[model samples]
Target: MRNNKEVNAVQATKTADYCLAIIRGRYPSLAPAEQKAAFFILEHPESAAEMTSVQLAAAAGVSESTVVKCCQRLGFTGFSQLKLALVRELATSREGAFGEVEPGDDVPTICDKIFTATLQAVEDTAKVLDPCEVALAAEAIFKARRIFFFGVGSSAVVAQDAQLKFMRIGMTAHSYLDTHAQLTQAALLAPDDAAVVITYSGRTREATDVIELARECGA
Candidate 1:
């Protein structure tokens, strides 16, 4: 229940930049339809920012509700709010050069430009990532006696990645891919335990169910 009352122009820019970073990190975990919506947002952000849910859905080859749901998964209230955030980003961004590359420019030149742009984006993300957030998350990890991570499909891969990272650091962590196994593990967690549910779209029913189970089990 975070509010945007304290968000100014700079904070808005940071939020937009962080949104892009999250999209990059989480894209592989999204469904095919959801990924299509994500690409539409990134590839044509200006146009997508101005679009209504229906218009965005048509452009992304998805349902209007699906487009709206994607926005929600990204922590937006709805399409209008998400669109406003993107528009703010467009306002702060530098304009690209108008000229198209000639055929003689070579593939390497194009590759270099793309790589440089991505590097710049990563740098921008680094500027906005809150050190305090990571510290708090670390504290949460340290305080919890047992940790359960849940994901499905590609998100399952991310869950396993987190599990391995924690285990290597000499922490207690478990990742579950199957619903039944997830329930069993969740039931074993005590009140002092915690669960990290990783779902890019946040609409995966099986994963959500596991989260609910963990909550009920006092995790």
Candidate 2:
């Protein structure tokens, strides 16, 4: 069993990682000043959580309004709300919130860590996902004349699996592992088609290109 200080430290680390993940997901779309503020928060989540809006702005070399705008862009109401969220996360985080396998771990330990990590991922996704948006996406897919799935790297494998499943359900679905092939398919997409772009980091160049082409084609 760990003492209070140790537990608090672990929770703070977990919260920081979670907050960083959110910021990173939104990094590509943020404005320059907002991105700078986000970068600072990513590098120093604990310190950012404790700092005032003005202090964080000075530290990130941005204006105070930029910090507040960054927080809002990150889905928070303001800097104060972002700070509150960080504090809440730190307080509510459980032990082993992010399970990691250590070297020389036995079979059972490895299995436990893997399973814990999976559960944590699912829970975190649930926390951020919007049910209304999911419903809209599902509706769009259902109404589409065809579906185009675009991805690269490991996400390409997932796109292929999605294609197979959609095909099994008697839907016209296409996915290509090659970047050129993906762009070609995207270019052929009609206005009635639906395109699903998958990327783990949300910053994959190939995935972005595919989405751009699909959108240009009115998919």
Candidate 3:
């Protein structure tokens, strides 16, 4: 029979992966206190290892009860369990939360690293995306009378690419980088139109305004 230590070892690995997945997928839906705790754990995982629940709660500007409750919501029994899983995961992860561009890297090395990072990102995204959700989105696009691609910065590039893909399929599609043009276009949209806003990081307040405008216009 497997020993207690062996069972715990397995649980630890699963806990780390599971907790991170929950944080990523359910963060926006979490309460403000829980969101604070979750973001604290994500942004300062190493610090979390050394801090007690009270300390972490203070740092996150939440109560100790909130810390424990957040852990429970994240699928752990309590704060200590959550911390153990997070610390274990952080210990094993080599890459920081974001992608890194190292200094003194040669052109070929940079290219190789960038390509590898991109592949890893796509793989990670695929793991999180539900096939059913993709099917629903595809069906919605198919039935739309018109489509608008809305985004800015790197997400803008993604929006433009989507515009191109729909255009190639002979669909009526539009994407504008200019704020005025985007507002004007959105204002002209009707209930028959649809807007697809792509913001991977979920940090696009300006793009959100455009979407709100489109929504108000009955798009």
- Highest lDDT scorer: 2
TM-score of each: 0.57, 0.66, 0.60
Q: Which stretches of candidate 1 lie over 4 Å from their true place?
A: 1-41, 46-84, 95-133
lDDT of candidate 1 at residue 156, scale 0 to 100: 82
- Per-residue C-alpha lDDT of model 2 across residues 101-137, encoded as one tens digit per residue: 7898999999987987677567667655656568888
Off by over 4 Å in 2: 1-81, 91-95
Residues 68-166 of candidate 1: C-alpha lDDT, one tens digit per residue: 777766666788877776776668774232223567778988777677667755765585766656686677779999877888889988999999999
Off by over 4 Å in 3: 1-99, 106-112
- Give the Å error, residue 118, model 1: 7.0
Give the whole-model CA lDDT for all candidates, comma-separated: 0.73, 0.79, 0.75
* Candidate that would win on TM-score: 2
RMSD of 1: 6.5
* Each model's Cα RMSD: 6.5, 10.5, 9.1
- Measured with C-alpha atoms, the lDDT of residue 45 in candidate 1 is 74
The order of the candidates by TM-score, greatest first, is 2, 3, 1
How do the candidates rank by lDDT, highest first?
2, 3, 1
